[model samples]
Target: MRVAAFLCEALTRGTTHAEPLAVEGNRLDFVDTLRQLQPDLVINLCESLAADSRGEILIPGLLDLLGLPYTGSSALSLGLALHKPKAKELLRARGISTPAFAVVQRPEDVKAVDLPYPLIVKPAHEDASMGVDFDSVVHTPAELARAAIAVLSTFHQPALVEQFIQGREIYVPLLGNAPRRALPLTEIHFGQAFENRPNIVSYKAKWETESPECRDSTSALCRLEDTALEERLIQTAVGAFSALDCQDYGRVDLRVSAEGVPYVIDINPNCDLHPGAGFAKAAAAAGIDYPALANRLVEIALERTHGNPSHRTKGPGTARRVDPPNRNVLAGRGPVRHRAGGPRAHAE
Candidate 1:
């Protein structure tokens, strides 16, 4: 079936604009472009785009208006997942284990917060380790404040200060919904460099593909021997994914402590799905090849669309939809409210 791949110009910049590519320089045009193509399905790989432009909102709304099926989580899930603080708060309330964190909008905000040192600081809304690096680990309150200010000034957003979990970095890829399948567990091997720098996936390690410091710092390795441990990891990964209402496929990053206790570090809804990316690698380990995996996602989207009859329409209408409020507004003020029988007591 034909698929419309919607990606932001920020991601496509400096890249070749070849066929099968519809580049929307501004995210506002995403819906209009999708309307023009009217493909059978839409693969939303547009994480780098601005959230306020309602880039997240427009996707699902467009699909609903046009009665088209699409891959990945719905717009509500996308908005919740994009806001780190809100996601963490929701997860915490659900009793899903996550790193303890404090949101910092300004340098002075760090003063009242009470998280431990060697704290990790990052842009609250950014993913793919945008402002995270070795310097993100701060030991002193002053250093933490400085890092928070730097991230806010650079990314123009609030900073998330979280307790740094020191242990093995593990990633579990989850697919399907009714009976979610967690692929093989992938570990980040720091190797000898851990002696010098202590293993952590910094921003440079992720974005700078050719940086020697990163090259020497990290590696993704799978194939674990312990069946019981693997089972536990998979269960925890699935729990976290479901807790966040993530759909289709996604990856959950966790850190296992010395006692084998896993803490959810991050839940990625629209993770990198390139054939060479971690998600694909993990799927391959689970016996789902790249093309098969992609097709499976399409099938899942169609199933969801068919089940939700009210969500379908013949074509895009002129109905205008308003954007939802920023998640920060809710999370920044106080503790988030949860429905009854919240957070399940899962391992991670």
Candidate 2:
């Protein structure tokens, strides 16, 4: 909410007011609210609808039906992105590197897996590390079956089993269109909380504020001196972004293999935008202040809007070749924040 206020104020130049519209569950009410408010533009910070992650893929379709211009990716891209395996297929089709993997809706389905061991399994249709935990990183067929079964039963979705890339977990956020700019790269550093455990961001590490995994995990400005490697990382993420036809702003997550090859691990459209999160941190590292980022993204979307009022922006990712700028580096410890009192709820 505070972040919204900053954006509202920043965009208020030459305007009356800008605000956020909160939609809980009532679909009609949301549509009616939009009809009434008739917002000039929408930032599309919605992460989900009615507490369901998949529901997020529908919001843009609604906005488009009402002929509204908005920030972020289109509904089609969102659909491909939410389904992890589908996004990987698109990436591979583009000749981009992603982990080798398979899907399983039933325990026995794991038998068809030809990939090597030490695979990570998670709910195929979910995001935000929702069905992932210590057991997600499995090494044996029995463990793989248990993990796949857990996802099938708990999340009621097919399980995605991919070869686990053991190395650095990096996030690349790209903003704008025609020339999408990749922000400073950010890396997740695992602390003692992950000792002897896989360096994956489990459900607890991400959302359970009180958990040790959350406590010890930190997001820091990735300091890679190898200009060539950095370029590869950014271009790989950009490749994934374009393959999905994502627009405005989005993030691509990758895990560098032990052999130093960066592989796309996740494509997060409409990724977290809280000031304390990775996207905002990368923006800040790029010398883009919070309000500036808020304002700039609006301009990006508005540019696409005025350029073609009727046509939805869709094309191969237009990447601007940008060189990295010096960063604050989160003072070396990384920009780590936590919800102090209790666990942050994972759902609506």
Best model number under lDDT: 2
Superposed model 2: Cα runs more than 4 Å off: 1-6, 13-16, 308-348
Backbone clashes in candidate 2 total 0
Rate residue 318 of model 2 by lDDT: 30
**Candidate 2 worst ten-residue window by lDDT:** 327-336
Tens-place lDDT per residue, model 2, 1-348, is: 444555666666543346666656535466777777666677776656766767777778888998877888899999899898998888989999999989997878989988898999988887777888998999999899889999999888899999999999988888877877899888888899899999988878878777898878777888998888899999999889999999888789889887779999888887766666778778888999877887677667767876632233434443311213321000000111232333222111
After TM-score superposition, what is the CA distance of residue 334 in candidate 2 from its true location, in Å? Answer: 30
Q: Residues 121-213, candidate 1: write the lDDT tens digits.
A: 888886666677778888898888889999989888899999988887888888877667777777776655445564677655665556544
Q: Hey, what RMSD does candidate 1 come out at?
A: 11.2
Which lDDT values do the candidates have, in the order given? 0.64, 0.76
